[model samples]
Target: MFIELDFQDNGKQSNYQAISTLAQLGYDGVVFSRTINDVITKNDICTFKELDLKELDQNENSSFKNLSSLTLMKNEKKQFRQYSRLNIIISSKKNIFLLKKMENILKTYDIVAVFPQSTEIFEKCIDLPTIDIISFDLSLKYLIKIKYKQVNKAIINGLFFEIRYSSMFKTKQSQARKNTFSNAINVVKYTKGKNLLIASGANDPINLRGPYDVMNMATFFNIPFNQAKNILTANSESVISHGVMRKTYFGVIKVEDKKKIPKELEESTDEDEDEDKNKEEIEIEKEEMMIEKN
Candidate 1:
């Protein structure tokens, strides 16, 4: 199944319309991402307002079964799921106070993405475990060359590189597009498309594209066809899984089918047994020594 992990237009469009469009476009799910700064400045109280609306509408319309029969039939063929994500863009030029403020809010979102504006910030982001995705600003003037070591370090820390296609189309300047393409190529080369995520980053309905269209666009960045498919499928799924784990269990989770005692407690119990055995041996030795003295 195909998934779109980043759709930035949740505030602009109704949830019903976006999901309906994605379903028609053959997408199984779409993740809605909003910047923490935007949420704070705009006073955007509800992050998943669209999905909540869909649920409320479904409940209300269920009573009018006959009137909504056609709509229900259309929805039954393709079910589109909605997920919420948060993006945290960082700039090296920012003051230390603001950077600390942003870092404090990292755990509040399902997905925490860092858009590094400089080499220093880029290096720091890769080593951070809370960062789920490293996003590049395709419209920027400077071309930040990605190194293999940094990309590998990011992958090892479970961070995915996010490339937004909408940035390429959003600007009319030729230089911006050229820089975007060049930077993207460098990123793909360094990472070798291992932990890469291709997203539309759609700010409007028109910016949204189907999975095949995105995969075809990946080829333009020199990504192999099979890896392009994985970018939208497996890699995107892995990103979502990591996001969920990060939010639910704080990054690492362990599950056991059988009841297991804590290792620290078991070690303590073993130490107690060892102490008892040592005491018994000492007593026996002392008694033998006493008998020999008698």
Candidate 2:
């Protein structure tokens, strides 16, 4: 299923509208991201709490008209899932400490992404398993060069690189657009298209694009058509899967699987048991022969 993993709530549009647009464009899921600063601010917290209370009260209303239209859309033939993520923009060592303190709360979200503002922060983030995506500010290219070693290490550690297409359209300046394109190409080059994810990062419905349209746009960065397609589909799915795994116990135990084990896997398990049994028997026979000789 096609997914867009970064939709910012910028007050220009309601999440319901943005999600409706995404569903219409054939997206199966959209992750709504809120920056750490916004989430931590007192005013924002109060506002969000008020809104939450209002929504809860509305839900209690018996009238069907008071129900969220998004619920109806979800029940439709094409199902759309909405997920929430917390994006931490790490700039200072102090911010890292703050994140450590808030890490437990952050883990409550479906995904937690880190946007490192400096090379030092980026290096530290490469080793952080809690952070799913290393999101760069794709609006402009920074002076710091990202080394291939760091990107490769992150890939080995199961961290994904995120490129937001919405940043390119946010600006009218040609130079900003150039910088965005250049930074994206540099990231794609360093990562070698492995563990690379392309997302809308859209703040409004107008900025969102269809899955195929996003694939076409990705090719502009010299990415192969097949790889670009995977960025939207397979790679994005992997990111979500990793996010889901992160919140589980040791990133291994998902909800207990109810389905029967595959025949091939069951057969392999049986074969492994038989091999162990035969090795034990052979050792026992060798010991017996040695005792007789003695």
Each candidate structure's count of clashing pairs: 0, 0
Displacement of residue 96 (Cα, Å) in model 2 is 2.1
For model 2, how does the per-residue alpha-carbon lDDT over 57-92 read when each residue is reduced to its tens digit?
244334322334345554675446667777877776
Stretches of candidate 1 off by over 4 Å are: 10-12, 36-46, 50-78, 93-105, 251-294
Off by more than 4 A, model 2: 10-13, 38-78, 250-294
lDDT of 1 by residue, 50-132 (tens): 35434534544433223242255346774456677777666532321233334435455556676776776676666555568
RMSD of 2: 15.6
**Candidate 1, poorest ten consecutive residues by summed lDDT:** 37-46
lDDT of 2 at 75: 62
Q: Give the candidate number with the greatest TM-score.
A: 2
